[model samples]
Target: MIEANGFSLIGIYGGTFDPVHYGHLRVAEELVEVLQLDHLRFLPAHHPRLRNAPVVASHHRVAMLRQAIHGNVRFSMDERELKRPGETYSVESLRELRQAYGEHETLALCFILGADAFVKLPDWYCWRELFELCHLVVVNRPGHALLSDPSCLPLALRNICQERWAAHADALKKISSGLVYVAPTTLLNISSTRIRTLMASGKSARYLLPERVLDYINMHNFYAGGK
Candidate 1:
């Protein structure tokens, strides 16, 4: 486990893994290394508040995610949001995690997301409280690049992030929460949407994701109808 200054750093990567792909896996792997995360939790959402419901069922998505990260020692899936009823709010999950860990002072929870999602933070339910619950690790997505300037960010989010910006990843290990760090991770062009479209069109999505995950998707015929 990765620890610094007597605090264990855990990474919470949440998304509607729809069907976990290499893009997601690569980012997680890189984040683990770059941030020196002790344990990285992949929290799959039941129904994202800011997005549409996943096309595939929760069970299937969870299964695919399991296969995708099968042998990764530091990676684990957290199914709490999947089991919860109704829309999934990140704040609630972080709150529960903070309580489970006993105190934010002892354990550092770093919530991971892409730059595209970070800009939309203000729209999230109780978004500001998230800073109090965990640090934010922002990575660049395919089209969205990380913007250092606060002016480039959404007004509300930009204002809050100004004081929360961390000079280095190590800063996360020093403080338990309320910091924003822009981490540099491998920029893979692969995306779940592209994979699904390829599968739906009866095209090959090989190498874009793990073979085990692909096999599982084929076995269940999960996105066969362009879902």
Candidate 2:
């Protein structure tokens, strides 16, 4: 069970983590520092709804995440989604986390998502209810546009847009009544897709991922496409 008192910032960094690269780690680190997060949970997806197929197995993804975040006291891993069967939904994960952490913990649960994912929040399962559960921290990603189109957001979300983007933290806190936030970070060109492609072509994936993670990937013969 999770516990928190006062204003606790817990960041949920959910992803496939195909092989857990540096870009992913960097984003988490930056969010933790910028938001002064109390703790950051790295949730690996067992089955992502948007992805046609996962590039790597859950066990491997989890292991890679562990390796990537090793020695970081502020970071931890949660296999809740991986333990569940079928499609992995953010709403479900947040619900379970809320139950574990209690409702009146004065807690702030922030979801770390890329720009592309942020743009598609309206299509997520029970997306409206998600705002009532936790805040969203949208990170800048290469090749994705800002979420400026109101039509792309649900009615519930659009209603809280002012508070979500308010310049003042208190204003953000007031509207947060279980609201969502959009934190745009520096854009990094790195991506798992590009890493996989490079690995498949017999090229080096160095600098794309953490050294330990890359070793694990090579040891497991991952992304040697057409193998």
Candidate 3:
């Protein structure tokens, strides 16, 4: 079992993490501070639903994430989705967390998503059930716009966002049922795709990702040898 390390409030950030980069970590740091989270959980999906299966294996993704967050006591990685078979869905992972954490009023779990991903929320499996499971922390990054107009949201999500948009960070700590927070973060312009491309062409993606992670990629020949 992964220890929460005395963290009552946690954020779940799930993604392919093919090779975790600084872009992913930078935003996480800001969110942890802004939301006052005890921990920001990095969850690497075993089988992604919205996009193609990650080119890198799930085990590799997990290792890279572990290396990326090694020193940060408040940041940890979970392997629940990696252990499960079939396609991984955001809602299913959230359900597992809700079950694990139980009904503690003091415990808060926030699901982190980029603005691009949030705008496409309706496409997720059991998307509507997400709000019932945990708070939604949406952040803006390149090529994605944070939704401001309620009309732009999916019909099903509009009402919930309208009703539950928290005006302050403490508002999220008050209740566990439903909360929508759009964080103004220090969004980095890095992308895993670009990193992979550089590595494939024999160029270094050194500073983009953690040093150990890059070493692991080099040792394993991941996205190397002009693939």
Q: Lowest-lDDT window of 10 residues in candidate 3?
A: 1-10
- Per-model lDDT: 0.89, 0.77, 0.84
Tens-digit lDDT track of model 2 for 1-227: 22332366788998898777888888888888777788999998998898766788999888888888999999999999988889999899999988898875467677778878876776788877877877777777888756666556657556756455534233333332454455656667899998989999989989888888888888889998412
In model 3, the runs with Cα more than 4 Å from the true position are 1-8
TM-score, ranked from best to worst: 1, 3, 2
lDDT of 1 by residue, 27-83 (tens): 999888988899999999999988988999998899999999998899999999988
Positional deviation of residue 143's Cα in model 2 after best superposition, in angstroms: 0.7
For TM-score, the strongest prediction is 1
Q: In terms of lDDT, which candidate is stronger, 1 or 3?
A: 1
Worst 10 residues of 1 by lDDT: 1-10
lDDT of 1: 0.89
List model 3 lDDT by residue over 91-139, tens digit each.
9889988999887656879999988888888898988899899989988
Q: Could you tell me the TM-score of candidate 3?
A: 0.92
- Per-candidate total of colliding backbone pairs: 0, 1, 0
Ordered from best to worst lDDT, the candidate numbers read 1, 3, 2
